[model samples]
Target chain A: MHIIIVGCGRVGAQLAQILSSEGHNVVIVDKNQESFKRLGADFNGITITGVGFDPDILKRAGIERADALAAVTNGDNSNIMVSQIAKRIYNVPRVLTRIYDPLRADIYKKFGLNTIGTTTLVAHIFRSALLKESAKHEFTIGNDIGLVEYRVEEEETAAKESGGGKK
Target chain B: MYVLIVGGGKVGYSLARRLADEGFDASLVEKEERMAKRIAEDLEQVLVIAGDGCDPGRLEDAGIARAQVVAAVTGDDEDNLIICQLARDTFGVPRVIARVNNPSNEITFKKLGIDTVSSTTIISKLIEEEATIGDIFTLLALKRGKLSIVELIIGPKAPAADKMIKELRLPADSILATIVRESHIIFAKGETVLKPGDSIIALATTDSEMALREALLGKE
Candidate 1:
């Protein structure tokens, strides 16, 4: 699948490398050319140096034919604008954005755009790890339901599988 | 009316001060705490909120919920767009205006149904109008840059100076709308005779602006 990733930051570079290695066509855009270095010499992908929200830059990145777009720019507003342009203008099938502000992320989600608030998610993860909690909240679905992962010991799993779980 | 102005840059600062002076309730939100404090001290009538305008919480604190109009004049186009969207879509503000830092982003802003003012576009237009020869000035742009209403002065040595309107070879998609001679306005007609010093207001396709000017004032 043809994918366009805005911002060649750590996450964007990693995503690009993984997708390109998986044989998917990946094009990453960053305002600074220096950001492309994060992708490393072995990474195989196209790099565009321009603002992600710019239509001309997006067109040059082949947004019209992109199967998916990820806007992981450091600026939340820039990411939101790029995701909106990819989804509403180019009609890219899949679009995702990373917004650091949780409130803004929730508000943008109401606009029908997929957003991940790294600040909130990271905080949640840190809290769970620091507390050594068995259950970790991965993400919240809509306003209420939270999808959580519960860690179980190997013995507990084996016992449960044998229908001998502790009461 | 209560108006919320985002970004404490020069444009936003001056606009908020002017609006407050005009007896309107104006509130400004600036990301830079120092600048916001300076503006708060400078503008007695304007209320200043120090926070990121893109943040809905900051906007709400600046009275976005009751704002009749929201103007996002940030230097960053993306931030302005986000603030406008938050004001219009979330707060349901009746009017939202954004300042597009990059002139090319004007169309995108317009496409998203957001009113945009591009200083770059306006400044470039002024420079273009000033640099234009033959005393032709673009009065207004219409049809999304497709057409322009221009005011051209018929110079003493112009080709169409003393010619009849019907005999003048105007550029395609161009028509003389009216002529102001000696403070008298005359609606252009086929039989009307052109005269030197007459300021002709014509409607022409933007692409034909130069041709129209050359047709009236001759090649310069």
Candidate 2:
């Protein structure tokens, strides 16, 4: 798959490495040329130094033929704009973005865009901590559901095996 | 796949519950007998053991050798790290995911070669940001938040269908990730045509999502 990634920060760089390692055609774009240094010399992908929202830069990164686009820059606004263009303008089949603000995630969903907020996941963790006695690990799933992990004791496990029903 | 989670704390218990929900075999080992008993009462399917997570014997008892993944999410960072390493080296678990209480510990975890590290603080900050921002959705954090993959559905009247991918002119910070049509995944490419029913997936920053939606659905 051909993937275009905006932002050369930690998240962007990591994504690029993973995708590139998986044998996908990856192009990474960043405003600062020095950011490419983070990718390292062994990196095997096209690197473009320019603003993420620039038309020419995206073109150079091969957005026209991109199979997927990822906007994970530090700024929320930048990520949203880049994601919009990839989907609306280029008609790229897959578009994903990283949102730091949990509230914006809802708005993004209304517009039919998939979003991830780091804080929401953290909240789940905190909530789990707060309610450690009742539930276990808690993480946000998608919009409606949450993925939570709980532990089973020996007695509970036995009850389950015996069909003892919820205790 | 079976998984072993060390700690009966919130993170550990959460991991157990989630794995069970997904129909995966999971067990928990906690040092506190009371916590273990409580966990036992709460989760019916998970196997709860009262023992030290860092001990090889406890891990073996939890079936770590056969477990696909082991997650150490105790409140203590050092304990989590040690348990994670033991799971990886001594038990030979395929994957180890650890929870970092402090953000600073993340770098050390990375250096130690932990498979995955999640920071509750960072995640909370992001959630707070989302609650306040009002325009983005944070879907999932992968690889310590280095990469995120998200999903979006195209509106029936989206202008995106009218234009070829080469012409839509998307913003720079984002990329069209993939299209799911009737469960089939279509990788984005220049020649790929957008259909009204296509469920799109994308990766981008938080704010640009609106534009991505407009591009696919056309102006709200």
Q: What share of the true interface contacts does each candidate keep?
A: 0.76, 0.00
Candidate 2 lDDT, tens digit per residue, B137-187? 446756555544556665567677745777887766578877888989889
Per-prediction interface RMSD in Å? 0.7, 19.0
Model-by-model lDDT, in order?
A: 0.88, 0.74
Cα displacement (Å) at residue A17, model 2: 47
Query: What's every prediction's RMSD, in angstroms?
Result: 4.9, 25.0
Worst 10-residue lDDT window for candidate 2 chain B reads: B129-138
TM-scores of the models, in the given order? 0.88, 0.40
Best by lDDT: 1
Name model 1 segments beyond 4 Å from true.
Answer: A123-167
DockQ of 1: 0.72
